[model samples]
Target: MNHTLLRLIIPGVFLTLATGCVTSTVDEMVFDEPSEGIGDATVVILGRRHASDYETEPDFIECVGKHIAARDKSIEVIGELEFLNALYPWFEPRTAPLKPSDIDKLMLQRPVAQKLTALKTEYLIWIDGSTVRNDSAGSMACGIGPGGGGCFGFGTWSNDADYEATIWDFTDRAEVGRVNTKATGQSYMPAVVIPIPIIAPVQGTACDGIGEQLLQFLSGHY
Candidate 1:
């Protein structure tokens, strides 16, 4: 991969899932229900994964909490790490989605056939992202093709995904408001395109470019 090109292309564009950053059009929500004022609202930033990625970044929830603080300092925000370990081991498959046991295990709210309990969590902002994939003839054929030829297919593997930063009113995990965003990334033939045949730039560039869409969403809620 061409490191220089990637560095030039990807940085400053952050639609990153780990940071709860998205680059979507802002959807404004006026606090009409009045459970708690936005200024005085206290929140716990949560980063949920497919169970695969969560294990590596245990403090990911906290990372997002920092971004929230960047957005609006008026609200009292905190990152609770005490619950991180329990949430990592269990997860529902992407096909089936997360189950009640899964949520209970993560949230530490397990009780079989339990009666409803009201939660003091006035606002639970669930920050997560969806995956987007693009595979094309150029992507594969270029990879195998001669180096210079590879650069020609640079944009072919480009695929875009929309990031979602959802606000769930903890009354029943009801989704109140959300910001949606899209991040696009592509695998390019870097060795072929690079002036010096560097590999690191190629990989970094694609990953970096993916963040822009995420940053857009974050610009709004903050």
Candidate 2:
């Protein structure tokens, strides 16, 4: 990215850590610039899963996709449905998520390569991980009655999320970049007549951090 801005940011990022150990660590690595491919490049964001039943949160995917599309106006961002439809047979009746090895195999095949290239898909971004409730203190219990459900409690909990985005360059049949984001923050949820929602904003954090980093890497800024 902007080396000057990066230099300035490094100090601030480090300083923020001194105040609290619960923080986010975002690491980014870019191998080579894909300048020639950006103009007509289409990217599909996939969630890498170990189990067939597992699913990635749609909101998180949408957030990251939206940010990437906004930053790179020329790049076409494909949603999950479009991606699945385009790769129909590859996913057929039953199968587990495509591991990195599987992706490599598919990319190296002539037919697969030709199909994706025809569709103008230059990169595939695979995201893995989730946000979870780490710890909770106090209680928030609700019950339904004739008057409806109501509960009372004063409680706090921590949300910790870790996600990694791996960018595979279909043109080169190799991974060109990766971004890892770890975020942890406290959340507050209270119930008077209804529970007050306290969002940790982990997904948003990961999206913004990874999205910007991905854009910079793609544009040769990093």
lDDT tens per residue, model 2, 68-100: 888777778898667777787674325423544
Model 2: what TM-score? 0.74
Residue 89 error, candidate 2, Å: 3.3
| Top-TM-score structure, candidate number | 2
lDDT of 1 by residue, 72-133 (tens): 55555545543233233332234221322333444453531131132124555555654444
Q: What lDDT score is found at residue 71 in candidate 1?
A: 51
**Global lDDT of each model?**
0.41, 0.73
Candidate 1: stretches off by over 4 Å: 1-37, 48-64, 80-121, 136-156, 171-174, 185-189, 192-222
| TM-score for each predicted model, relative to the true structure | 0.43, 0.74
Best by lDDT: 2
lDDT of 1 at 63: 48
